[model samples]
Target: MTVSRVTLLLGLLLPLSAHAAEFDGAALGAVWALPFAGMLLSIALWPLIAPHVWHMHYGKITAVWALAFLLPFAGRFGLATAGAGVVHALLAEYLPFIILLTALYTVAGGIVIRGNLHGSPRTNTTLLAIGTALASVMGTTGASMLMIRPLLRANDNRRHRTHVVVFFIFLVSNVGGSLTPLGDPPLFLGFLQGVGFFWTAEHLWAKTVFMSVALLAIFYAIDRYWYAKEDLLPVDPTPDTPAFGVDGRGNIALMLAISGCVLMSGLWQPGIAWDVFGTKVALPQLARDLALLAIAGASLQFTPRALHAANQFSWAPLKEVAKLFLGIFATIIPVIAMLRAGADGPFAAVVDLVTSPTGEPLPAMYFWATGVLSAFLDNAPTYLVFFNLAGGDAQHLMTALAPVLVGISAGSVFMGAMTYIGNAPNLMVATIALNAGVKMPAFFGYLAWSCAVLLPLFAVVTWVWMR
Candidate 1:
């Protein structure tokens, strides 16, 4: 099902003959829908093929998919500039966003610790709450990285540790990332697209409260059972270590430097010029390049050798991300192009279902659907599509639509933890966990956790806040 075919089919079926011409079959197929469709097909087929062809893990296979799809851009732009050149430019420009996210994950992962828990369940619960709160500032990835090791260390003497990590993923890795734009890239994309920076904070109170409460309750119950079991074991008196300490205070500066570079990259705006193809070409801004260079430099210079010493700072994580995202980028290019061409097609029908009597959009429904799809899609583009859709109405509707946009943005970031491919950080967390000998569940398996645990909490959030 190529994008053009889908567009042609939709064009013939739509009653709005006046708008039929908007669907450009070839362009639609090539640029809008193909990339996403390709990604789905590739993910579905990769496992069957990977063992024989590559001897790679599923993560590495995903990376390969991203790279193969993305490689064409470099080739076309460098030596054979044409239609392909334009695509290469587009993909290359977006590459830095992924790198920025990877850096965040690396820093977070480095700070985590694993030890035995000696306090009451309430004490551990308080710590988890504090850690999740920190996720908003340090990034869910950073918070997860910083805390997972400690949580694991705390439970090292116990056999009942799996549930603790599971809860951590739900609260810290996924839901906790919603409060700030810096906490999640998808929301940051919303910020770049004219959605205000503080928008989420103003609007997400209900979601934050709901997920927080539900996760805390679930953790308490689970932790109680585990605590009781631990009481049966003989207590060994080990020297009491300090609750927390800033071991590498110097590293904080490097962390800030890297973070600053990432911030500058997000704020970079390229200059636009008319091109030979009758379209605008936006040249990369100096800030964008410099920011990336600074981040790369910092990662090389500041990362402790012992920190990366165990695994040799293997390119595996980055490599895997590149591969999976390539397939995603290429596959969805055409799909998005088609969707943009026919803004009021079947998809619009879906959107219209959520509109209110006064033509006001419903924030709760929009938030849920957008968030859910973002778990599987490239949320940056997904955010753009929804933003354009919601913003396309008269300017007067902006106020009415603001909450909807916030909901979408918040939901996308929060729920991205639902699956490994939901957001970049999810995969990074998984990889780092794997490196630490904690095997994360498979794609669908992880989603089951979210569906059972997070979705109900999100429902309550939507009811209380977004409704």
Candidate 2:
């Protein structure tokens, strides 16, 4: 949207900001979730059924769905409450979320791995393993952006290389990110809620290893089968070089700085906070955001243009994410409020699924419940929902209810591979592959791949571990 429209919308909403109050979830009906469902459905179906329209007018479409909720919400509740909800979503959630993503995207895009190796089955397995290792260090977004071009270039000569990208999403984009907050948004949300920095890595390392090695093994077998068909191009599109090295190495330091900023926010608490439309804006968070913005600027200013060109980096994907997630965050306010209400609210059935007859939490049920929703909804907020449902006490969760937290974390991070829309980087990787002439599967086709390969493994995980 244009700046003028944004200004006007803020103008309308800010008048009652001082009177902002939280939504009463018990009072909200299921109908209030329509806009959230509509937004998700539009994201899923619109692209498949009407690619042209969706591509051209997704921003406008997102705006419509957002307004569909906002207008009705204003009429049902008072204008003050609606305005506060928007303010909270924007200030507390959306801004920090988008800024961090943009910073990661910019920094990672700058680091280009030049030249290529032949995409042998061994070589492919090794690359996937390296990416899986890096996912926790540099973030799934950063690692995916940095690794995808090299992987694509390596396989450009092969005819049946789409499976390579699919497995990349399964391993590097999702499961590999299970080990740290920087690796995935959901884990970061956990960090923001007081989960320790190394907590996920400590708790989830074994699970991550199991999933990553298993997927890599499966990929190797499948890739060898495809490789045996020997459908090679007479001449490779991207000829292999004697040695490959990386450009834009400075972004590595910037990434570390970004990591430091994130860690600082989690560790440094000055006991100072400001209330903006009923949202708590902490000093550390503000400082971290400003530092992140500066880091992104530094990356753009210092990185050479040729590196970005070679990477084929564009802001289009980030812009699409920013717009679509704005609608998602806006429409999801009531849904989250309802979920937060537990048994008294509209999502009582969802609450029941994770709760035992004796009112105890069920780790196995938490695993499936969080995973299934995460596959279809935004995994970050899905993580938050289950986190809250499991009693949003981070210290208690880390110690007494550690198993339940494990289920929630693993589900949010790993099951994101189940669909293109499940995680931000899943679609981003698919788009990159498609642009490089890899014929990626449609949304449902990818779903088939994930379910066939992933469900059995997840079942094993539940039986042996979570249960």
Candidate 3:
């Protein structure tokens, strides 16, 4: 693929400019506030207008939302050129990482669930366990997509199977994704912003343990309930079964190749070796990224089409992801740009609110606010805003702030289960489930499940660990 010079130049320039000079803290804070305000306005008004003005279909509604969000980017671009003398000046470096994370998770998800079409009772339980583990590595989206199809297939003979997928979304797609940066976009953003990769892993262990236990417990109970309900229904002991087919387990190699590519792309950063558009740039981190891409490209040649056939390799899932996330990319650009321009002033009050009573440090409030906003707005930008705030001080406040940061990370990834729009994977799972004839609950209905189930567990997390 021919790389766009424009894109390459912009990539080289933006980071240089961001690092070369700092903007007014007040301006940056004000800009950051716009998105938060917009998020509130969007969520508040979406309900009233969603029923009457927008189509109920997920694709169409999400498309409209994307367009609405993009308008601000155009304005920001013009404003930045005129006044700030910069173009695409927001903290946009994380966008590619976001895309990489989304794609990696999607592919990983597809791999985990490929084999268990028409899962038996034993298979369903196994899939849940496997899917949960996959959630920590490939991400909730990756695990959810990989497992959702087989899960639906397992319950194909039953009538009360919709709830199975709902809880599946809650477990594998959202809450389970909280354990690592690989599990959620917000934390990945943290990594790019100088937050160490192992920091979240180390700090969030308690929250992860708490939530994982809670989700597993809930899933087991629900699975049992549904299992009993299945027993009451007439059994199709002799139902027609699809032919058992096997191919080279080469897809596992392919999956690993893809994952390496994604991880490298995610961790790659521009360095000072490259120069473009009057700026010097460095990107030594691209080595790992290039290697991963090379592996993926090679897999296309080395892996036979027959393996993909068994996996039911259709482009539809990736296509849907591309289409929707493109809209997301377009819409949030301006929102984030504006936030970057003026985050310090408007968000200062929010920062104060997040501080400890003695004006020392408070991580708990930081986690709660960041996590809550992450549920609606893209978590990447939310992470950036908080990171910038936290990094501003040269002093080591990690001990004080670490718990809060972990809280934020966990909350963002876990609570993404609250709505279809909460995280990319949540919607993907819903789409796949619906496509397979399982009707997911409405937005508010899903929120009710999260509140009743996830919130209590989160409280436990706060008390036991974050406090």
Q: Who wins the TM-score comparison? A: 2
Candidate 3, superposed: residue stretches over 4 Å from native: 1-22, 28-95, 102-123, 231-248, 258-272, 275-281, 299-344, 392-400
Task: Give the least accurate 10-residue stretch of model 3, judged by summed lDDT.
Answer: 82-91
Candidate 1 deviant stretches above 4 angstroms: 1-34, 44-93, 109-120, 231-244, 258-285, 310-314, 342-349, 352-360, 376-381, 391-400, 427-445
Give the per-residue lDDT digits (tens) of candidate 1, residues 160-197: 65567667777777677777666766665554444444
* TM-score to true structure, per model: 0.74, 0.96, 0.76
Residue-level error in angstroms, candidate 3, position 126 = 2.8
For candidate 1, the 10 contiguous residues with the lowest summed lDDT are 17-26
Compared with the true structure, the alpha-carbon lDDT of candidate 3 equals 0.57
lDDT, candidate 1, at 431: 59
What are the clash counts of all predictions, listed in order?
35, 0, 26
Of the two candidates 1 and 2, the one with more favorable lDDT, higher being better, is 2
